[model samples]
Target: MSGDPADEQLVRQAQGGSRAAFDMLVLKYQRRVERLLSRSVRDPADVADLCQETFLAAYRALPGFRGESAFYTWLYRIAVNIAKRHRARQRPLESLEDGEGTFGTDAAPSDDATPEALLANRQLVRGLDEAVQALAEDQRRALLLREVDGLSYDEIADLMDCPPGTVRSRIFRARESLSARLRPLLEGRGGRRW
Candidate 1:
């Protein structure tokens, strides 16, 4: 109950046994929660299931939720934990689909852009995706939560259950690893630094 005032009101109502208020909260954050889940869970079906489970857990725990952090931050913790448990139950030998890149390109090429530029953009995006996927789980998660999600190190540390220094170290190592992996692809672009 510590996010937007609207959310706080809704949480309070939900805590007082207002189902509609809780549904409103779900509608507000459903897409964001799904997007977060998609970063870790490859299967859309599984992501949807985990998202439902996240909200369900939240609703059940709403009465005990103190206004210590933002509502989204609290919900994110639940989602992350659910995704981790799901991953743990998955088989290690399961094969992943090729070209299923989770990370997106930095910029989309305009329609007026040259074909060559578009091709280069695609290559860069692919390289980034592969490089990110190659990183250790902790590094990858930390990097995405920082860069893509734009979360503070403190927030990430809370979600990750680590010290802020550890989160910083993980993101640094992730960036270094990605830079090394993508250097060759980027070198062809007039020696631009990644």
Candidate 2:
């Protein structure tokens, strides 16, 4: 028997009506889901509420999971969907005088962005691009495939003609490099808030 139970095993146990198994899965993924939600939702309270909702939705849909993808990947999709719905519902209300009011005004910018925020955002994007470009070619490719394209390690390995273990290592190193480059600029500014 395996020394450590895989997520697949926990998923199977959860699907077999084991509440403790499901709780284990929840504990493992809660922080990841919260971080994902934080990217979209600015309010901590709303993030917590949405995190709970995502897990609840996942639990209800657990029986239907077919294992075509990793459980975390499946759970990630559910969390994303929940965050999208929460954002849609929490969209800012428009004034009567604003003739072009629309549901997704958040994306369209109902008002002008402050100069400071705009400059900070632009700098952040530039730094991110520079950091990614600075990575070794293999590391850059692996990071883009896994992060930007959302490809699984196995899929990235097939495309890159490398082993999955190598792909994992490349992505990890790429992230560490980028983080080191970006940390100074992001300090004391509530980095994720932007």
Candidate 1: regions farther than 4 A off: 1-3, 92-98, 104-109, 112-117
lDDT of 1 by residue, 1-194 (tens): 44589999998899999999999999999998998998878788999999999999999999999978788889998998999899899975322354455765546668798989888888888888878878998998899988888899988887787999999999999999998888898888875656
TM-score of 2: 0.51
Work out the TM-score per prediction.
0.82, 0.51
**Number of clashing pairs, model 1?**
0
lDDT of each: 0.86, 0.74
Cα miss at 152, model 2 (Å)?
7.2
Count of residue pairs whose backbone atoms collide, per candidate? 0, 0
Candidate 2: tens digits of C-alpha lDDT, residues 156-186: 7765666899999999888889888888778
Instruction: For model 1, give the 10-residue run with minimal summed lDDT.
Output: 92-101
User: Which candidate has the top score in lDDT?
Assistant: 1
